[model samples]
Target chain A: MADASYPDGLLYHPEHDWAQIDGETATFGITWFAQDALGEVVFFDPPQVGVQVTQGESYAEVESVKAVSDVIAPLSGEIVEVNADLADAPERINDDPYGEGWMVKVKLADAGEQQGLMDAAAYQAQLG
Target chain B: MVAAPSDTLRRTALFDRHVAAGARLVPFAGWEMPVQYAGVRAEHLAVRARAGVFDVSHMGEVETRGPGALAFLQRMLSNDVSQIAVGGAQYSVLCREDGGVLDDLFTYRLADDRFLTVTNAANHAKDLAWLRAHADGFDVQLADRLDDYAMLAVQGPAARELLAPLADGPLPARFHTAELTVAGVPALVCGTGYTGEDGVELLCAPAGAPAIWDAVLAAGVVPAGLAARDTLRLEACFHLYGNDLMESRGPIEAGLGWCCKEATGFVGAEAVAAARAAGPAERLVPFAFTGPGIPRQGNAVVGGGEVTSGTLSPCLGVGVGMAYVPAERAVVATEIEIDVRGKVRPAVVADKPLYRKAA
Candidate 1:
């Protein structure tokens, strides 16, 4: 987590979010850059499963010791699952942002929304 | 979208060192200061358990000199300035004539006819102008020492031990100061700190600060930042200028009556005495969450008060904060509910220090 990483095959949002796509489902989480900027996250108020999420809108809130940041949704979907483990160990967001740190899994409302996201290389370039 | 540059923010003498330490720099009181290095919890724990060094160079200093210095400061400061012996440090508040707190400061008696008062960065300019405007009748000279020195606070149980070897002579005891050569640089080491920990605050020349800072870090002192400083001070129940202490409230209401000597006849003495005799309507008290949820500034209390400062105490592992509530309900065991955002979080008024060292 100390080094900046942007895994390929993951779509990136300008707000520093990532979406890992499956058949019709996708896992969403903030990117390494976002987590690094937020410092050590102490709290993650996860959104409830079965809630609707709109792309470009905040679905959850992440709090560090000194600040609170809004975690935006990268794509529109119906949230099917929330990462309950983060309730007590929000630091995972900084440790494994792409894996266990994934915030929510959603059933995509429109897979076509992926067109708006950037690839890993493009996201890295944006970060630069 | 790209973020805008913080070009207008001022930098301290140790800014480069903070950057090299991978600190999270943030704008504080118009200065680009390190909010945290490593992490707030880590830095906070480091200071509590061992020694931690802080770049407090942003804090301002004012020098009052001349034969009338004592009388002039006695009129301006809320505490009994006449009692501070040479080499002694006294904490006091500057108040408006109407009893509003201007700023909380620590004045060190450097000499019989000279004193140095450290001021909050945000209120330094206003405090300077206020002192200068009132210098008409008094034969005192006020010099702004804001840029003349860089401040570093080495704090914790092992603070003295960590700083001793590099010091040319012995460090000052608590609430005292001594001039010494630290890391080969001339410095005024004051035995004081905001963190309720044993420590010395070093005021050194700007040019020599980087070397001193590096030497302290080299001595195993964890580099802490403003975020850790806030948590540590809050755990100690120390009043933060903008939060716990404010112009809208007098020192008595802010639980600082012990430092206020109305007989000294300082500015706002009459109003403070009146407030003291009659008692303040609201009293600032430290509180901790009985349940979950961190209380934050401006969060409304269920009753007639509001939280002024709050955080998840790194030491206590619980939500702790200070609030101003009706004096009647400020008792230590009184239960209070804070409206955090929209949800009500249960809390109880605790002792002055919400966190204490384990026995």
Candidate 2:
């Protein structure tokens, strides 16, 4: 079956990550497609909750059974709430990468940074 | 079917056939090989429950024939090749005299004087050159026939049931081979595989691979790729060459002590014998997590002041892994911790072959 996608109100990154902005808070997670290609997420290496991230820079890593891949920052921000749920249940990334699998919530360093990332159609083309 | 990239790593003879069958092509060992047609977990379950087909033609096939073939192999390999009866196969390693592994391979005893060696794709040339350089006075003809032969592995419990109908004769009783016609194509069906499952590896002419692939696919056999193969093998606790075992590792250290038969005076005899006599300093142990975290390869496995390879097992629902445990922590069921993120999670020394069918 085809996988589900992140719901509306989320900004997507070409690298298959999502940034959902709520006021100054931005919750982020990988897209459904990224988790599928990664097989199973065995381990995660996210920056500390208060760590700062720059758009386009790799601020975290995810290791699957077959290979290890990086989780790039979607927008410049400071981590406000890193998903504590994922530290114990990385499968959340595999089962629901966009929801409970939310990787990190950020206080957007610059709201304008959203323009650099992809929208739904653009990210879908990246899959092609 | 997906359009395969022209610049994709070179394909085996069955490349086009795999693409046509909707097999997912991925780069493996520098070659374009199908990872799966349906899906990795699906194909893996099929191979476990029913049957699945795998295109392993990318693996190198080396032929050593003539009078001194047996002696030559006996000297180059760590296992006693001379012990294998005709039509039998022995899993052995090509080793340097220093006891380091070059490549772990299967040696097929085609005849009393003829042998076929299958090495991993990445180590083909090195294995061949090592054997050739050491063959100074041996009377043998070595040929690299990998390009000429295509190997198909139909594996699982129902492997024989599915293949019996396609073959002209009854399936070869386990580990034996038969000269047969599969889907009207001339083929040699040998019972062997890497998944630790019951199966046959069909070695046939390059021209016949396509036909054979179609015949198997048409029979409802799931098409599996390296992804499934890796997980399946991991479930069986089989070591991957580059990961679990390598040039820096020895058979004794890798839990392959059985293959280091002392009877054969192979190249690494002295070192292996010494290591065996002295006892190994570290041991490879299978472990699993019940709490939280899936261990990936290269993750640090901490126990008794030692760190080793920790990886998630695709077969076992839990995080299973292999690691070099110090002598103290090598005991079965010893507790250990795997560093997942900054948290050192609890893990247990689990049983080997964490996923195995009833005997």
Candidate 3:
């Protein structure tokens, strides 16, 4: 988690979130940069599965021992599923931010929004 | 990562060491300080279980000497200054004439006529000015020793054992101090710590701090940061100056009446005595969440109070915090509710030191 990394085929938001687009459905989670900056995630308060999320807005919260940070939504969507495993083991957000740490599965409101997000290369460049 | 402007912020003598250790530095009390190194929970547990060393050089120091030193301190500090023997340490609060707290300090009596008081970094300049303004007729000489020394606190159950090998002589006992050579440098070793653990605080010259810090770390003491320090102290129910004890509040209301001796007639003694006689309406007490939510500073209490300090206690594995609630509701086992952000969380007022060491 010390080194910064961004995987290919994933879209990145300036707020340090990643979206894996799959047809009308997408998975969202915070990036390694976000988790590393948050220091160990001790608690993850997820939003309800039916909740609506708007781009560039906070939909959930993650708390460390010393601070609490809002988990920003990268795209507008209606959450179809929430990661229930994070309730007991939130450190997975730091251990595997992309795969096991996926926060919510959403049905995209507008698939066109994906064109606005940056690719892995562009996101890594912005981090510099 | 978002970065603060570092040009205006001060750096301690161990700034380079913190950077080398990959600490996540943040702005604290106008200084670029490490909030965490490995992690807050890990560092906090390290101190509670084994040993952890902290770079507390951001804390300031003041030296008071001369014939009227004791008398001057008696008027300024809440405790009975005359009672502190040489080579002893005492904790007291500095108060305004109106009884509002100014700062909490720990004074070490280095000699019959000389004493050194450690000040909170945020209130150091204000404390120095207040002391100097009140020194009109006293024969005391006050010197700001902020830049002269760097402080390191080695804390935990094994703190003494880990530090003893590096000391030229025996370590100081609780509430005591000794002049010893540590890591080949002359240092003032004091048996005092903010964490609820047996530990010693070392004060060494700024130039010699790195050597001593490296030596202590090499001895297997985990390097902790300010974030861990706060969690540990809060779990121990120690009052933080800005959060728990503010200038708008008196020491009595903060549950620090035990340290304020009215017979000493220190500044604000009359108001403190009056408050004691009448009893403060609200008293600060430690509380822990009975459920899931973590309370935060400025969180509203359900009825009529506010949480001043809050954190997820690593040792207790639950949310613990201190709040100023009505005196009638401050008893242990009293059920309370904390408005964490929006949702209300059930809590119970507990005794001091929310976390206790296992026997």
What TM-score does each of the candidates earn? Answer: 0.95, 0.87, 0.98
Q: Which portions of model 3 show Cα errors greater than 4 Å? A: none
Clash pairs for candidate 1: none
Model 1 lDDT vs. the true structure?
0.93
The lDDT-based order of candidates, best leading, equals: 3, 1, 2
- The CA lDDT at B141 in model 3 is 100
User: Mind giving the per-residue lDDT tens digits that candidate 2 earns over B140-212?
Assistant: 9899877878889999988888777888887666767677899888887787787878889898888998888
- Put down candidate 2 lDDT per residue, A19-44, tens digits, no spaces: 88789878888888888777667677
The alpha-carbon deviation from the true structure for residue B336 of candidate 2, after best TM-score superposition, in angstroms, is: 1.8
Candidate 2 reaches a DockQ of: 0.35
Which residues of candidate 2, in runs, are more than 4 Å off?
A1-10, A32-63, A75-128, B1-8, B303-311
Quality of model 3 by C-alpha lDDT: 0.93
Best DockQ goes to which candidate? 3
Winner on TM-score (2 vs 3): 3
Number of clashes found in candidate 2: 2
Q: What is the Cα-based lDDT of residue B266 in candidate 2?
A: 86
True contacts kept of each: 0.38, 0.38, 0.56
* By TM-score: ranked, best first: 3, 1, 2
Off by over 4 Å in 1: B1-5
Answer with 1 or 3, whichever has the higher DockQ.
3
Native-to-model Cα distance after best TM-score fit, residue B290 in candidate 2, in Å: 3.0
Clashing pairs in 3: none
What DockQ does each prediction reach against the true complex? Answer: 0.42, 0.35, 0.62
